[model samples]
Target: MAEITTEDGVQIDLVSGERMKKLRSMEKIRLILDGVRDGNIVILEEGLSPDEESKLIEVTMTEISPDEFAGIEIESYPQQEPNPGFFSRLFGHNPPNKLTVIGPANRIETLHKDKNLIRALVT
Candidate 1:
């Protein structure tokens, strides 16, 4: 697993695989954003295309509040967490405490701090 720090200074972990494929999908990015808002770290397995990565970084930096400081980490192949019980899984789903991303190193640090840019990318 790879680790990254967001502009907000929050630490994140990344895991790549079939499981993360769904999470990285375009439609699910919004859900990912929602999860991030709750302090859940994201995990991208197959990694994102340059464009996708750019969009994600753009969206994330812009969406985050100025008072917040989160960081993102990237991992090539990460371990999976154990499954929770039925009740917890059904009604108490929790996002991972660490966030992660698996992709190019260059684009990782190009955090754009414009809200309009982030809204355009995320929406």
Candidate 2:
């Protein structure tokens, strides 16, 4: 991985969609976790699937410690489909989420999230 420098003590890694598409599920989780552990915010261009998000939380629980590591904060909104086709409705296939933000819980606070915006405070 290339080095990403922080400005004003904040580092934001914006992972692009093409880069994300090439990684496997576990790889994606590791990438996100590593950034959070290093006190950097990670933004995924194409958000993870529901299963992936759940697995991430599960992994994070195992890694949390009192002094060394804090848990992470994750936020995302599912992409809205203006109209669902009959098959989509019957199959329960929802569109993928638009983006994901992951960071250390103690450092990043999510103030608000709606369909179009996410307001976060980073320390």
Candidate 3:
């Protein structure tokens, strides 16, 4: 087994799409916060909840510093993306949010060089 952490590389989590949506909004937010603090760039295989998205934006703004922000690039796809299509709207079916990369700017930058992290983040 290998250790997993932001320092090690881009940490990822595969959140259950159906289960997450069924959770309370606050629970979703808390779950996101925990992953953020843990230094794992949460890869929501499922889209994020509206409340979860709002809270993520708020926390990112507060938690990261200007200098750190410069070195750490954050990318996130809200569980709820922009205007979905008619079927997605009607069926409430949206693609899994997928990889939300977050970490030290330089570290994230080196992702291209790390095939392992790329594999983990992607697969």
Q: What lDDT tens digits, residue by residue, belong to model 3 across residues 10-83?
A: 57555666667677876766676566565555545555544456566676667666654432344544444577
TM-score of 1: 0.37
User: Can you write out model 1's per-residue Cα lDDT over 1-123, one digit (the tens) per residue?
Assistant: 365766765545455444455554565456455545655455554445445555766776666554553533233222234876788668754433222332223224433434232111111
TM-scores of the models, in the order given: 0.37, 0.88, 0.47
Candidates 1 and 3, the one with greater TM-score: 3
Displacement of the residue 118 alpha carbon in candidate 3, Å: 12
| Pairs of colliding residues, candidate 3 | 47-79, 48-79, 71-105, 72-105
Error of 1 at 106 (Å): 21
For model 3 the local lDDT of residue 65 reads 67
**C-alpha local distance difference test of each model:** 0.46, 0.88, 0.53
Best by TM-score: 2
Better model by TM-score: candidate 1 vs candidate 2: 2
Q: Which should have the higher lDDT, number 2 or number 3?
A: 2
Worst 10 residues of 2 by lDDT: 1-10
Ranking by lDDT: 2, 3, 1
